[model samples]
Target: MDLAVLRPGELTGADREVWRALQSEARALGAPQLANPFLAPEFTLAVGRCRPGVRIAVVHEGAGPVAYLPFERTALGVGRAIGLGLSDAQGVVHRPGFHWDAQELIRACGLSVLEFDHLVEGQEPFGSRKFPVFGSPVVDVDRGFDAYLRQLRARSSKFVRTTFAKERKLGRDVAPVRFVHDERDPAVLRTLMRWKSAQYRRTGRSDRFAHPWIVRLMEQLFHTRTESFTGLLSVLYAGDRPVAAHFGLRSPSVLACWFPAYDPRFARFSPGLVLHLRMAEAAAADALAYLDLGRGAKDYKNSLKTRELTVHEGMVMRRHPVALGHVARRAPVRALRHAVLARPELSGPADRLLKRVGRLRTGR
Candidate 1:
């Protein structure tokens, strides 16, 4: 096989078509992770437009392209998943049985080290280098919203009942509540971003919207609409005021959950959960199959998820000094994070500590 690297926007019209076909075929062949909108070529193209150094590696065998990898390169010869830190699904979009040496791929990309988190499963070579695996929760809505509700109620009847009760009370206490599954208004998008930014700082996490590129990328994605990839902004409103909102990406079969936040004033109403339930209903109505909640441990995920998917995180490296230096700086941090995540006992304390730090950061 031969590898050709080019910017994501450099793919010819025919090549883009072929890329979509490859992704669809891969999904049918049992790699459902390919269904993630984040793995779509359009996503790469959007990121390429907003961020510099975004490239796509096309792998060709004999007469045609068989796989693609979208990544970002840095000046120091370091590489990362395209939209790394933001993208929840990362890996090569390859044919079912294609395989390559991890180090060889790294060399071909002209990088000494390639790093990724939330790397999709079934990715060999790189999977061999993974530090730990995390469970990404997903809501299976293929059988329609009603069926999913039945399953959810079966799993946590009280949680479902209480959430529904809160939704009704939210309507009565605030205003008549309503949900909009596909909101096109840009103003509401900005509102969601502001809420998300405040949420990040409040939780002692880096605010993603503080970066110009991430903000520009989301704006670009908001206008992106296609069969393989579409930006979906769903909102739960009390009368005319949006109580909670979510902006995620969707392919025909799967909706990859991304940014979700709600007005802090509505915290008691559980607006976030209410928004997710409505989003799932809308996704099912749109004939989508799954709502990928992304890899994270949160109470809402535990309450709503129908099942879990495994995603790995780590690096693929070549024998270079840059690679060694990158590993030395990152491995310990990654190890500590995984250790904490693996044990609820440790995770609770860590969370509490972070919140305390958050309070200080927010001057509260």
Candidate 2:
């Protein structure tokens, strides 16, 4: 196999053509999780332009393109998934017959260790070494939002009823509720960033939007207008008041849920959950198939999801000294995380601990 590494923006001409083709083929694999729009050239290029050092690997056996891998080269010969902290899904996009052999690919990429937090399950070679898989909640709206709601009602009547009831209460108590599935106002995007930043600080998580590149990436994506890949900002407004919003990347059929935050003042209204349902309704109307809520646990995700997709967090490394170091650094954290997540007893305390830390940091 011949492998060529290029900066995400450097993908052009025949390479671009093959990349698009491979992306199309990968999306056609009939799995919503596998059809990650983030892997598309447009996304990688946008991210690469904002964050330097992102490299794309194009692998070919004989003639046509077979697979593509996008990663970032960090110091100490360590590699990470292209948008490690942000990307919801990570893995090679390859055809069914594409060859395996993780070590060969790692050696070719000149990396001793490659780490991924949200690796898409089912990717060959890498799939072999995937850490404990976790459920990523998704709402498959291909059939129709009405059908989806019916299914939800069948599965969890209380959840559906309570959410709709909250939405109604929000409309009555505040101004008549309004949900715009695709909000175009740049000011609204800024609002989301602020809310997200505050939410991050309040939760003891690093504020992603504080990073200028991530902010710029969001701006670029919001302005990015494409049928196959584009930024989608959904907002729930009460009168002129924005209650909750979500900004995500979407292909023609799939929406990768990225940043979502709500005005804490309206927390009682459960605007975020209401926004998700409306988002699902709009996405289905737009001919979209799925809304991947990414990997993580949230009460809303569990309640709103029609099904679950598995994602992995771990590293695939070569037999190098740094590889062991990387493993030692990440594995313990991963083990602790999964352990905490698997048990509510541990998870609750962990969350409380994080919240306490966040309160301290925020001086709250």
Candidate 3:
């Protein structure tokens, strides 16, 4: 086996060809196409757009690419997989039966420790040593929106009825109902960013929209379309003005919900809920199998989820003394970070601080 760390521009044509071949294998093995983007050269470029330290590891056996890991080197010899917070499914892009160990990969890359926040379940080469297990909710829209709603009502009757009531009242008082599943309007994207940023501040979380690269990436993704995955901007309009919008990715069988926001000015209309309902309807019409709400425990997610899927993340440290020392020092710091941020009490204050910091940094 030959292993080497590759810089951003060092990705060769052979590398991309091998990558596409491996992606076919991954799809054959039942991996979702969303996982394919993490392995794509374009995605590597996008992450580089946000963080310049992005690196790629190409693992080869007898001149054929076996696995690819896209990561970023941070300060203090720390490394993280590319698109940690943003990616729904995180893992190495590899063919099945590939048996490289995580610790060995870390050592090969000459890294002290490798950390990932959204590592996909069942893809961990290091096994159970990884910490922090969480589940993401998904809604199956295969049969259709009405079928999905029927399942939801059967599972959580009151919740569905209540949300539907809110939707009805919203339409009655606000304006006639309007939903665009694949809206290409840039204004809807802008509305989503504004609402998402406000929600982040209101809840004491770091506003992802505050990042210029993230904003730019969303803009770029909105215009680009691919067979396996394409950008989707779903919007609900009230009297020709968008009241709620969701920006997400759609593969043939799944809609990976990302940023969703509604106008606070029309809060009484429950536009967010209305938008989700419409999205579900659209997903069913599109013959998509699932709507991934991503990792989080929001009331809406709980109410809409037909099932939950587990995901995990952890650090894999090389056995070297330097790596061990770094892990020893940083583990507690990471724990503290999670502790402080995870607490409900700190959420509001943390969001406020992040918003203030974001404003200072961006002057927005």
TM-score top scorer: 1
lDDT of 1 by residue, 224-303 (tens): 99878899899999999999999999887889999999999999999999999999999999988899999998899999
Candidate 3 per-residue lDDT over residues 258-282, each given as its tens digit = 8898888888767788788889988
TM-score for each model: 0.97, 0.94, 0.84
Worst 10 residues of 2 by lDDT: 25-34
Clashing residue pairs in all predictions, respectively, total 0, 0, 2
lDDT of 2 by residue, 94-195 (tens): 777676688888888889988888888677577544377778889999999999999999998998899999999998999999989888999999999999
Compared with the true structure, the alpha-carbon lDDT of candidate 3 equals: 0.76
| Candidate 3 ranges with C-alpha deviation above 4 Å | 12-41, 128-130, 320-329, 336-364
- Residue 350 of model 3: what lDDT? 64
Instruction: Tell me which residue pairs clash in candidate 1.
Output: none
Tell me the lDDT of candidate 1: 0.90
Deviation in Å, model 2, residue 114 alpha carbon: 1.1
